[model samples]
Target chain A: MSETGDGSLSPARPSRGMFGVSGSSDTSGFNGLATPVHADLSTPKPYGSWYDEATDHLAEVFGGFGDAIERIVVDRGELTLHVKREHILELCRTMRDDPSLRFELLSSVSGVDYIDSPRRLHAVYHLTSMTYRRRLRLEVATTVEDPHIPSVVSVYPTADWHEREAWDFFGIVFDGHPALTRIQMPDDWIGHPQRKDYPLGGIDVEYKGAHVPPPDERRSYA
Target chain B: MTTTDTPGTGASPTDPFAPSRDTTEGRIFTLVGGDWDSLTDEAISGTEKMVVNMGPQHPSTHGVLRLVLELEGETVTECRLVIGYLHTGIEKSTEYRNWVQGVTFVTRMDYLAPLYNETAYCLAVEKLLGITDDIPERATVIRVLVMELQRIASHLVWLATGGLELGAMGMMLYGWREREVILEILELITGLRMNHAYVRPGGVIQDLPPGAVDKIREFLVYMPKKIKENEGLLAGNPIWAARNKNVGVIDASGCVALGVTGPLLRAAGLPWDLRKQEPYCGYETYEFDVPTRENGDCWARFEVRVAEMRESLKIIEQCLGKLRPGPVMIGDKKIAWPAQLALGSDGMGNSLDHIRNIMGTSMEALIHHFKLVTEGFRVPAGQVYVPIESPRGEMGYHVVSDGGTRPYRVHVRDPSFVNLQAVPAMTEGSMISDVIAAVASVDPVMGGVDR
Candidate 1:
């Protein structure tokens, strides 16, 4: 938290003095700032809004592999498409190329493990489309035994590090990643830390005459 | 630190570890039984490359970000970024906290812009409970106001640090000066500056405090001039422009492929702002334009951010105008408790004016207070994902409940972590100097990245 000579955080302000608006006073806009806009929550939610239609359209694009699509959940203005592990890359490719539903951007790729689910591992892809200004959530489910799915790196290069992260944390392997090494965790780390079944603590490092139990052995404060 | 200028310092039988022509070119008798003279060409002629370890403690990194750089004559051949040194496993920790208490945790994750984190988490929980409508009008407006203010503060840090990275020390100073105004506003309203848990699940922690309106008014007066002064210093300067312009250019297609968003996506000639495309917190009600540009360079990103700051100011002004006195939190006593007044000279729970009625007459008031605090509200068993236009990009929270007070699982899609994926794509093949410019453009807050 070092300070500059003028007592500002950063020495230069790039956009300064170009705009004619006087920075000295808060008079003009603040005085006439418009009334608060009330949100209309009472309107009946359309049974199949445009978002739902888009999801269905994406599903149709993967016709032969339609069985891979498990469930479509639309909540909080986001669409989540749950798919099987084997068909994730294909689904992502289709979603990206489809003109009607161009989910070109894979905004985020992270892994989650539902301890209770039969297929415990899930690689969640948060996709966005620049053209349509719409978002779609693509999820692929796998088991801890073989957490392999074809990489979407060909479709979206950004998936390289994201896939590496998934591989590192949940042990979900992406097949076609050029260099699918660990991104956050160390290179030779043993266990997938984010998985629900995995313990938080490292090995049995004894501390103060007591052998330290694995993370799961720790008590839950709640 | 003796210089081993002597060509061959008496090599022993165990000195096969010595650098030699055998090691460099493998042209000589590369025998295991070679003497010291056989390795003379190998040791001195071998290219000297320096390796610098930049942190897990470096100040410029913002957090415990460690970089191992292989430098050959000031040119980096390879760079390895190491993180998780700041990892608190907040996502895993989220599973054990209740929906209401979860706001406090998420807010701390993106320490710079805590409001966005709180808003995203609450929106997800509200969606799961199907209580989006239950969020009061005043609450939504207040949420929007605070979030936009947080955006300005967050961007100020980005501008300051980005300038600092490029050796423009003055920019860093002005940036913090402006950010302090936002912090003061936060403290006045929420009782804390950085990690204010004001925006909660059902509503805010409480209503806006006394004199919050005037403080915000004063800040609005002070900020614009400072922003203008900052722009004057760096925006059009020949050196700054040369250093940033076209230094790290990534087009729309490239940006899309890398999953980059926010100013980076917009600078790449895509006008995909979440507030414009998918309006949250009643952003649709405000009249503000999505700032976009054609040049996908460091300079373009900086320009877009400057324009965005103006838009945010417009939105903030609008919120103030509509700041008609009303309840900040929802009226559901089941979720929010009644504001209690202080007692008189004789210490007691109730004020002297209403002491008789609270103790003797109103058992319902006592019961309501007790119920509201002890067993917090319960959210139904379900999952919901909510996205908000954070300063970084589309920040979202995916929360799951299992018919209990605590959430079954809570995961945050922090924009910094997500946006960091595009860094190498933006930096590869470009001059190593452009790496700093490109990274500064993405504006990553590493807490969010590591979390």
Candidate 2:
């Protein structure tokens, strides 16, 4: 920690901003101060509260729990299980069927695009267990080149629309989905609009000889 | 729009058959070559079913929602909900703006329960900032009060529109009439009626206005009588009962499997309200019941919603008695908005006193104010999902911050969007008219559904 002239202590870390952009052309002088990032993602056991107990039960039921799970993160009183992309279907079945860990309801499914990271596209699923009254987040990260994850629609029928939405926004294909059509965007939309690299607006205008490049070819604060 | 940019037989807008969506069994569309007899025979031969397209634009849809129904005579064989007509990309838009500016976008998501959107967003942001407990008691009480008031207003709209669709003309006008009072009270407190972005990250935007507590207290007395009158109007009427009873039924297991929530889930006798179960924003301390019904039908949802409005009035009364005077926003200067607004002689609200003090007395305060306002405070990089019991259901905000002034991503789990999935389960094998009652019971606001 560094003590400022006013005797206030601040952390020492790499800086990137106005809006978390690094080495950008849109330099408005908010790129100097270091901000704290909660990077210690993997929480050590004995994870407190119902989280540890839940994880223990999930491990007991699923034979390949260690292989299926990439990491376990607990932050802000929520449990997030980073699951491998290939095992999502099997893991969801275990979560839903096991008596001790009956996560019957898949509350939501969303996606995130971390542009500079190696495994950039993340498909996130929020599962709710009415039997245990618990919530768990299952995250599956994959690269932009290969953005395929198993669909949980068979286990949780509610995943039908949510999976389609994730595919519509971020282009993370949920393999084995019954009919994975666009849910939120028009079917003719050319590119995923929610990726970090996608322009906020003003990229494509359908006029003759209109030259417009997509996925952030304009001046952007991103 | 590009799908119909040009008109021709090949580019015909009527033949919107996308192969990706054509997974139904034995479904085919053969364009008739002006042969009325053959067309009639083909449609009635059981090899082809009559398909009805109701609304991306009809009155019964409540908003812009389209349903494609394949029918056998009067019974619906298949019901498919085609949404996304009202997608505004609010989730993608929030990634580009600062945290304080996010509330404006989120409140427009579930327009009926706008306060719930604001509160859930603020609570998630607060959780990311690690200042959840630092929120003052007065602010929490005000948030609970305003949200419950929003609940009543939202349910009133539900009743109004649902009644209008089901042939109860008087209930439509009466339900909307009662909602205007709640909107007026909201306008008096938050300076706007519909999309009031009053709840901020650290706390609420400002303290309750003068006589706001008394107005809410007055509403607490007035609303119960209106709720009772509504029940009396619809509860015993034979037409209402026939139109609603046992229509559009989905039991508890089906509700949970489809992720249906709010009054619909409670109407299935689950009583799984997040307010009573998870208890955020001092809701655990409030004395209220989670109303439930035995049958999972349209009429049961109506009964549950009516009882819920009474419970909301009870909570609002408790909030009136629990109101205390304190700073509504947080005390931290770096995090709080650098202004204390007051009405000026020019008939505008501005932080004149704060401006004068910063300009004249403290040069440091001036610098702090400029820095804080222009480049907002940084939040620690993390993701959090905060869920609240909205009038419709479990409205959740899954917010991710990258330690910047702006959010990395903001995903809203609108109950309307999730609950609309249950329409097929409710409407299939039922009469065509029950589709209206089913959609109304689901209450999927297209703004929320397509956001």
State residue A111's C-alpha deviation in candidate 1, in Å.
Answer: 2.7
Question: Best candidate per lDDT, number?
Answer: 2
For residues A74-138, could you state the per-residue lDDT of candidate 2 as single tens digits? 77777889999989999999989888889888889989886656788898899988887899999
DockQ of 2: 0.34
Instruction: Report the C-alpha lDDT of model 1 over A1-222, residue by residue, as the tens digit.
Output: 011111111122222221112343422222211111111111122324575467556657777455777665554445567777678887888888889978787776778776656677778887877777766777787777777888988988877777887898889889988988876666887888777566545447578899876665566845
Q: Model 2: runs farther than 4 Å from truth? A: A1-41, A205-222, B1-33, B43-45
- lDDT by residue (B185-273, candidate 1, tens digit) is 98877778888878877677666767888888888888889888888899867888988998778888877776677888898888888
Per DockQ, the best of the predicted structures is 2
lDDT of 2 by residue, B176-266 (tens): 9999999999999898999998998888888888888888878888888889888898898998899899999999999888999999999
Please state the Cα-based DockQ of model 1 relative to the true two-chain complex.
Answer: 0.14
Share of true Cα-Cα contacts across chains kept by each model: 0.31, 0.49
